[model samples]
Target: MNNFTKIQDKLMEMGASFVGCSDVEAYLPENLKKVKYAITVGVRLSDFIIDQISDKPTYTYFHHYRAVNTLIDQITLRGQIEIQNMGYSAMAVPASQTVNDLEDRYSGVFQHKTAAVKAGLGWIGKNGLFISTKYGPRVRLGTILTDMELPIGSHVVRDGCGSCRICVDSCPAMALTGNSWFAGCDRSHIVDAQACSEYMNRNFKHIGRGSVCGICIRVCPKGFSK
Candidate 1:
């Protein structure tokens, strides 16, 4: 009925698995502090492609990964345009772009999981990935920060990965720290980014150019449970 509902409905119609909104003022940089709200969009990855992963990423998985990221970008861009048409300011964060200038080289302009968690769609997994309540870690996220005041999700989902170390044990890079994620906890506590990056670059260059490794996603019990 309202603008938020209209936008959310449109995004879901565009193939997004989930669409959520949250107040993310505290997580913004000074330049983006004006856009205090975030719209979190998630697309569930293919079970067939994800299942193909064992110890390393497959060529098909790499292509699938890029395709999903591109899809997320398109969806968020359309969402951003819709918000602007509604007389609000919006910026679509890239689905997978890394900036070397950031304090964390492995991160994007903003963490999609942060917004997704605040939106109550999911929690951060031990693998440092967003584990959707419905889809587990098999979902990729996109975000659109805006000045619009949208209704936020009330139920903040807690870490459901209690004692699950399957992803940790399965990581060939040994990048996972077996640490559970809590709101506001640093990413390093859960993953060794440098180690993970180096291992992938060294071994999986033929697949996704070492940019992707879905072993953790494949071994995650949460995704296969439902």
Candidate 2:
């Protein structure tokens, strides 16, 4: 097997629900073409998410974000170290990189999502979400940018959402109808960040409060509860 395959297997054994690699070159967002290599990382969610829910101030959903960030941090550090050992220059890019750079230094492309989809980790669902076999759409993602050259993987050719509209029908913000073209804002059918932001801004009781109503997550038959 190639280094990419070996790394992918190693990641899966390390507790990753899914793993994939792609040639960032092909999908190079014009702004980020300077990047020679891109690594996409993802972690599956568990019922641990349910346990972190609260009705208190700020309605913290800490475990989910924490778990995701932890995975991203560990995997990124490990990968970067390995790259350097192999004589390559590598760097970790936070999700915030897109925001920090804004233009020349960054690409509008969300690296994690792009790398994941291109690696065949999942399909870009009609809901505009990446749906993987083990986690459906319940997962957190991150990416790394490097100058390392490695074997590439194929993109997920089949969409898991053959005919499912649960996400569309379950959107509380009435933000979904179809694909990214009509479904909702920012390419997610289940989330209307705008409506949610507006609601959270105006309403007092729930304006700043609990679990962010994951009705779509709860309703997805293919999704995992734990």
Candidate 3:
């Protein structure tokens, strides 16, 4: 097997529910442009915990979210190491982190969703979550940017959320704009991040340190099929 295929297999064995590679040269900053390829890793959240969510996030679901993020980080870190051992450069982006330097407090060092979507693993839902075909928005994602040349998936250029307003209607914060997503669409067209953040902080702070609310994720009908 090729080196990339071997790495992919190893990541799956390490507990990644989904993995994809993407050519994200255009998305990288000037200094980091050398590593144009990205390896995206996703871990499916527990359907039982996600289904337990109603209007607010349960403590169990909150813990599950953090735990899944930690797992994804571990998987991506291992993938990065494996790539480096193959004589290539790699950097594993954190599973979930807010970069203060960016105008968007919700922004990370690199957006995992970007890599995920470009990898054809999912699309951006109206609620601003990565909507996976198999798990809807109930999946935590991690990414490893690398200089290693690997086969990449076809870029998903269109949104899959056609006429679905469940997440928008279910959002207590009224943060969702009910707009469809496109490859280059602005996030403001689909969700009000500030409103979503404030609403969670105001209402569900007692549950998960006010960092989570899963109403939109629970309401999404995609991935519910057995």
Candidate 4:
């Protein structure tokens, strides 16, 4: 098998529910621009745990979210190491992390959803979550930036959300703007990060220290349909 296929297989064997590669040069900062490709990994969340979440976040769902993120981190870190052993440079972005240095408090070092969409694994939902075709928003994503040249999937440039506004209407924080996502659109056009963050902190502190509220995830028809 080719190196790319081998790496992809290894990632899946290590617990990734899905894996896709994308050319992400445009999304990378100048310092890391040399790493032109991104390997995206998604770990599907527990359907039972997600289903248990109602209007508010549940302790079980919160724990499941953190557990899935940790698993994704492990999978991506292993993938990164495997790529490095193949004589290429790779950096695994944290599965879930908030970097305050960015103007957007919700921003991470690298947006896993960006890579996943570029790789055609999913589209961005109105709720600003990565809506996987198979699992909907019921997935936690991870990414590895690499200089290795690998075959990449065709980019999905169009928004699939259409007229759906379930997430927007259901958001207790009124954080979602109900905007359909398109490539290059600002995240604020879909979600108000400050409002979402503050709402969770204020109301859901008992669950996940107020860092999570699964209302949108639970209400999404996509997950239920699957």
Candidate 5:
């Protein structure tokens, strides 16, 4: 198999639920501009656990969230090593990390959704989460930025949520703006990050140190079979 297929196959073997590549030169920050391509990975979360989430996040969900993030980090690290073995430079973006110094307190070093969307994986939801074509927002994403040219995913999926507001009305924090997300729109247009963070910190600090609230993921009907 060629390098692209080889890399993809290895990531799949490493437990990635879905994988895709995209040319993300336009989306990279100045420091990351050297790597013009991105390999995005998504891992599906437990339906049983997510379904149990109601007005508050459960301890089980909190543990599951951290476990998934750890798995993403491991898979992305392996992906990075595989790319480097093939004589290309690669950087694995952390599965879940907030760069507090950035102007956006809720932001990370890079937005995995940016690469995932560009890779034709999914569209951003009204809840401000990546809605994977196969799993909706019930998935966690990992990314590896690379300089190696690779096959890019096409057929970008459009917003599947048309007039649906379950996630919006279900947000305990009332942070969702009930606005549909379009490409190139600011995140602030759909959700208030400050409000969401503050609410979580105020009410759920005992759960996951106020870092997680999966009510939106639980109420989303896009990926539900029931």
Candidate 6:
């Protein structure tokens, strides 16, 4: 098998259900230049516990994203060491934190959006997030940045979301960044993040903190039941 086939087999062996590598050069933010390849992975998080956590109305529940990230880190660390043996540099970057400032984010890590796009995971939805072909937008994303010049798949610029505006209609905050967000019309139907956050907080007071309402996720016309 070729290098990609070998890596794909290895990722599967490491428990990665979705694996693809993309050229990280163009997607690399200006501040981060050492990156050459982005190996992407997605773990299935569809479970009843996520709903149970929402039902409990608390933040002390198990979020599968953490486990997914840990698995990605472990696999990437091993992959990096293997790449080093092949005379190249490799590193797995951590990407499982809420943006504190939203300004310092995406500095050096490969563009998760573009990386997913090239990897044939899915198209960019109206929410400025990647939608998985198999899992839709429910799955979380992570990337490993490395100096290893792995082959990149084709760039997916065609949009699958054509005229379907369920996400646009369901966005409570109107934070969808394309037709509404790109137009800079943030004062109208636009949801107030503070207000939206406060609403979640209010729900938390009654049920659970940081519970995912998933109205938008449910309303989305991708894969999965609303």
Question: What are the TM-scores, per candidate, against the unseen true structure?
Answer: 0.97, 0.72, 0.96, 0.96, 0.97, 0.72
In candidate 5, what are the lDDT values of residues 137-198, reduced to their tens digit?
Answer: 99999999999998875767889889999999999889999999988899889999988999
Error of 5 at 41 (Å): 0.5
lDDT of 3 at 183: 74
Error of 3 at 77 (Å): 0.8
- Model 1, 104-140: lDDT tens per residue? 8887889898899899898888899888999999999
| Model 3 pairs whose backbones collide | none
lDDT per residue, candidate 6, 50-79, as tens digits? 344322322422345456667777777776
Please give the lDDT score at residue 198 for candidate 6: 59
lDDT of 4 by residue, 29-82 (tens): 788898889999999888888888888888988888888888988998898999
Question: Per-residue lDDT for 208 in model 6?
Answer: 37
Residue ranges of candidate 4 with Cα displaced over 4 Å: none
What are the Cα lDDT values of the candidates? Answer: 0.91, 0.59, 0.87, 0.89, 0.91, 0.60
- Which candidate, 5 or 6, would have the higher TM-score against the true structure? 5
Task: Compose the digit string of candidate 3's lDDT tens values, residues 1-226.
Answer: 9988899999999999988989988888788799889988989888888899987899999899888888988898999899999999999999888898887777788889889999988889887889987788888899999989989756654667788788888999999999887777888988998898899899998998878998988888885746
CA RMSD for every model?
A: 1.0, 4.9, 1.3, 1.2, 1.0, 4.7
Model 1 clashing residue pairs (backbone): none
RMSD of 5: 1.0
lDDT of 3 at 190: 87
Clashes of each: 0, 3, 0, 0, 0, 4
